[model samples]
Target: MATLSAGGQQDAACMHIRELTMNACKVAHSAAGAVAEGIATGVNALLETVRPREIELDRLDREIDSAVTTHITGATEESAREMLACMKLSIGMERIGDLLLGFSNRALVAASRCEMEDVRDLTLMASRLEKMLSEVREAFEMRNLDKALAVLRSDAEIDRLRNLVFVRHLENPGGTHRSESFHVVFMTQALERAGDHVKNMAEEVCHLVSGQSVRHLLRSIDKPLEQMFLDQLRTKHAL
Candidate 1:
């Protein structure tokens, strides 16, 4: 009788342990799903901000800021830490957008008094930078490392264009008025810094996905890594 009672107790304890484990797994899965949903929502909101639509950029910034805060505070898992890092990167990218908008506003204000030729080069540079900005944002949304790396490479092009425009303005002070020259310099610096932020975000993406810091890797290496990711996607598709 004692043996029977002991065996019964053991079975009950095993069942309890199994139930506990299953419950824990369910909770973990629920938390992971929530985190993924939050990230997707945040990315979508950011894309809307980048759209050429008349939406207020400040509103998008506030939305992203709130999302980052919630993502960091709402979860207590290691994965949440990675998510927080990505959110921080997103914040930086969004700030770039804000800066770009400021430049646009300032350019519009200065248009009344500024010579078109004086600001023409700067305007062209701004247009190219804006395209790069869009590409970086798209890379993040799609998690395309290749596109992100391409955006990084394009930064050098932007820097070159900025330098060229600055040099032209310096060579002929009469070509660009003093105040306009200063404003151009300021806006160009902001755009260059925005490119840097986009590159930084690309590095964060690599770290988040692979647990590896490839920030030091050359742009050359990033190409192969991107190809590897593409190959993996292809394999998954085949399966």
Candidate 2:
């Protein structure tokens, strides 16, 4: 059997990284789904299922780390940038998985004590996160900057939901004892922070494909989004 050339090896390594990152995204998405259901339905058994998936995400993160370290030493600049993007994405997904697991644990303990409003907001956050992860997978797979931008835009809603929860729990006017307020707040934070990591992954996807940060693209371009993306692609190809 003939040994693969260096370029062939690098290509294989990058593909492996992409595959592992996609798998991690799926795992995180599944975790989010489980948390959403567990919170919405008050099912402890539903929440119990995320722990092993969290372990799978960690394993994928380590695998991505090793793949990048091994192949990035002698790679071309473009390939190296993509490999780094893969590493960033995998790390973000793993953190998101951990956050979802934490959220699930909190739900197990506090879902009973939470008010209807609290459960509604928490479920909404998890459901939104699940959708975001789905978009992250699609955006990364297709290198779709538009989808990535959409993910970035959706993060604000998560932030808003988190703030709503905080205001309700932190300042009750009647001097009432809010049972499991700490757990509710912690769960809110975990979902919000997971949204943040998802945003970072979307930014990395934009950067990986377009050679520009999401902030730069959104701030510097005055044209419509589709036009700006088209112009950028033209500029890249013309170089």
Best by TM-score: 2
Q: Whole-model lDDT for model 1 versus the true structure?
A: 0.51
Each prediction's whole-model lDDT (CA): 0.51, 0.88
In model 2, the runs with Cα more than 4 Å from the true position are: 173-177, 223-239
Query: lDDT per residue, candidate 2, 178-212, as tens digits?
Result: 77889999999999999999999999998887888
Residues 39-152 of candidate 1: C-alpha lDDT, one tens digit per residue: 223233323333332133334445545554544443445435454554555455455555555554554445345555545545555555555555655554566766766666
Question: Which 10-residue span in candidate 1 carries the lowest summed lDDT?
Answer: 27-36
Candidate 2: pairs in clash = none
The residue pairs that clash in candidate 1, if any, are none
